[model samples]
Target: MTKMNHKILLGAAITLASLQQASAVPFAPSDARSMGMGGTGVSSAEVASTVQFNPALLATTREDDHFGLKIPQFSLSVADDGGFIDEAEDFDEESELDTTGQGRTNVDLLSDLLDEATGPLGLEKMQQGIEELKAAQLLPNSAPIAKKTAYDNAATKLTQASEFLDTRLYSRNPSVNGEAGLVVYSGAIADDMDDLNNKALRINGGLNVAGAVPSKKFSMAVHAGAQVTFSGKVKIDPKDTDILRNYSAATSAYLLNIDALQLALTNLDENDSSTFDAVDTAQQAVDNFNYGGAGRPESEGNTAIFVDGELSPEAEDADLDSEIQMIGVAVADVGVTASRVFNIKGHDIAFGITPKLQKISIFDYTQELDSEEEFDSEDFSENQEDYSAFNIDLGAAYQFGAEKQWQAGLVIKNLIGDDYESAEYISSNGVGGAVVSISPMMRAGISHRTSWTKVAFDLDITENDPVAFEDPTQYAAIGGELNVWRIVQLRAGYRANLAGSDQDIMTAGIGISPGPVHLDIGVMANTSDIENEAGIALEFGVEF
Candidate 1:
């Protein structure tokens, strides 16, 4: 093997090792034959993977199917900065966290204060503020939550505030230019965490061993495999909007007063006679929003209630959807299958089934993002859950035509429908627990084949009910392949979601089979001004 190839294989081994700790197995394991056909193996199966897609195809009886073995296979599908892979590979971005640490901020003067306000150290300050309020008989009416000490109460509230940010991520990092800057411009850890959540890149891959044995009209195949997948997304939970609005309002007013105080004393605006007037206005604004019960402005002519002035944020945005979301799924499956075919009238029809066992692991992690601790891999399992089940897949395929080259196939996976509980993902937001429904997955396809060419169409007839925090999808796909005397193959196809997803994916693949040894590769991509996504697959095996 070439040095580069050797290194790539070594890296894959290392990754599989790390992923194993998390109990993540590959989600889907596809071979070159099906990859070359745009993921259509139902009625288009030309190889042993019939064990996975349509066991029925395994019963078609192949002249050279006595034994088949796939030593190893790997696939990659990534979007959003290549799921951090590209970033890790690039040397220039290695120091990005350092460069942006605490230096690059709009409010350079308040950077230190910002850190204190939004970090572990700041909990002490918040506690002190509460104690001072109690000393002055200005304690919050909602104080003493859970009968804790002053510092504990303050810390608890602060924690809730952080969770508010965690559950309802802000849309895009707020700029320090207007009302939007209340949370982010301060260099708050909460804001930084939201930014991290938004950059959720997705990565998935796998490893496996599979093959088949054929005997005239009765054939069967058995296989085993594992996969690991990770994905991230960011959203704001509307349920927590009101609580966050209060914090944001009070915080913005306080910070604004400080800025206005500085501006009131500025020489740049000194030429203006209303500098002191602006200062008084800022002071009044701060007091009005201080959450100090039944208070009035210190200014002689100012009042807390203004008939018309800037107002606090509404209870929620027009869209109540949360602002940030992320999910990681690790699942493994092992199965044994069998199939049989019968000739009736002028058509050959086949039936197949596979019973399997699956184990799924879940992680529901929430952390003080933007902290040094967040960078440590050891902390990844702060929130995790696991589940296991047994299932079965059933498939049927029919071929009718003078030459029996026309075919139709159907398959149902997870036929019994297994429900795996997700980690309890709760904050101020409403219940969005991690429960996943391992519902039935149904697929169908039709195809026509000749000695040198094949054409096919496939589609998802029912949605693969969500097992994570993601949208449901249904797809329509069409593909074609050209073969050169079973020695070389060229393939291409297009697949799109019909369930209102912005998906327009294109696929292509090539395969070379020199007798018993075969090699194949496939590519898939969908890019737009807003998103760029792509995937590739490679498999090697021998057929006899």
Candidate 2:
């Protein structure tokens, strides 16, 4: 009834409706080179593109005039079912009674009879309706005209019940029935009401950056990224049929109370009416039906029936759209290494490690109604901060036999402590820790010193522990590559998930090299789910 109670109810309603926000999950890139095949470059000197894979690899940069760029696209979707109510149904029936033939009923007698029927059970039900109406901001004090209109509508239904119940039940039970009849009638009435509501949402965003390594062993770079998310849903859809049923039950209770009161009034006489006070008592009973506040007041009017009235679908939808953006900076190896021999035996190795700092920003806003048309600001702000952590990677490769026909390599990624702490969100403390990959590779089928073509195969084993972050899994990829005219290379591979969702990744890529510049593009496609996902990546590098 007080302003404080009104605000509390409204806040509770908003909390209950805002439960559909979306959360972000971890992601992985499917490109073989990014996955650590030959180590991301034509040679072992640090290049701009390598910074994205392993920062430690940047330490091996031997070239001063080299630069590279990379662009990638990724997407995912999830399907959810079973949870919360979706629909509501309600119905009402009415008839008129000729109370004119009967002597004037004492309103006092009627009030006593109706009170007996409701007792504690009816009062509890009425209180619940009031609570819901208050939460919706539909209380008489908040929306006076709308509140009054709903109250009158409910009262009119009660008036109609006076005629219907008087005609039907008056002849059957002229005396008081036991509490058993009251309970049965009350329950039956509650079952006819209906109420329904529905909701849904969508989110999207992206990141971008530019930087360079100033020297061979030590290099510095700068990066920037942004994210945008939006969500919205509509009610009154066919899915929300349950809401209607609740309404029908509430209306039925109102009518039943009126009928019971009319019967009691009929039992009182005129002389008793002056002293009996049945009509006055009945009026009080009707006023008590206003469940809008803590205690019944004449000014409150009938608030029970309108308690579950319609809500503004648009206003509700906007409230759900707000979410935070996640931004971060990552450092990795960007150098290149070159082979010294053409055949018999050759060796080259490059390593990189990346330490990252991230910031997550979430914005929340609430709406308050003042005089319907006017509004006032509560508290709103854009707060930005950061989270810091580190991850490391080591990569190496060896070539054997004439024409460097055989090659083998090993890579260790995220090889550090698992937990990362930031201002907005704490990454799982269990340590993103480490992932190990071993690639036993081979190249053959070359004729002579002037041969223009060659073929190669790489078998890899990767241990990905998304689990520390609550997602854990292992994967393997078997792939082969072909070179033509010493200018173009084609690659294809099959990858398999060893833990969690058992799915296969089919991948392919192409590489082009002209003089000192090299370009590589790769595509990975998931074939398991109906809404399959495909990932594409591009990498550029130059050899000095």
Q: Pick the candidate with the highest lDDT.
A: 1
Query: For every model in order, what is the number of clashing pairs?
Result: 19, 68
Give a tens-digit lDDT track for model 1, residues 1-544: 0000111111111121111111212224556556556667777866566777787877764556676667666677765432333322331122233335644333232233333444543334333433432342233324433222332344344344443333222222344322233344323322322333323356667666787785546776777876666655443232223223343444334444434433433322323435435544643553444331134433311212221222222211112223323456766778888888877685568888899898877655443111123223553465566778898989898877887778899988778775454464433232554544566778899999988989988888886533233334576778899999989999988776676355567788998989988888988777341245578888888787
Model 1 spans with C-alpha error above 4 angstroms? 1-28, 80-201, 236-326, 344-346, 370-372, 375-382, 423-432, 527-531
Q: How many Å off is the CA of 409 in candidate 2?
A: 3.3
User: Residue 55: error of model 1 in Å?
Assistant: 0.3
| TM-score for candidate 1 | 0.63
Provide TM-scores for the models. 0.63, 0.42
Q: Residues 1-544, candidate 2, lDDT per residue (tens digit)?
A: 1000111111211211212122221223223343222222312212454343333334334344444433332222221111111211111112011135443222222223344423433433444433432332334344545544444444344444444333322323335532222223322322311121222222223333334453433445433333333222222221112212222233344545555444434443433424124434554454454222225343332222223222223211212222112222122222232212112233343333344443433322223211122222222232222334333344443444575444444444444534322222323232321121111121111111114433333332433332111123345445555657647867666655555453556667777878656666666665564223345555554443
Which whole-number lDDT from 0 to 100 does residue 311 have in model 2? 20
Best-fitting candidate, scored by TM-score: 1
lDDT of 2 at 370: 12
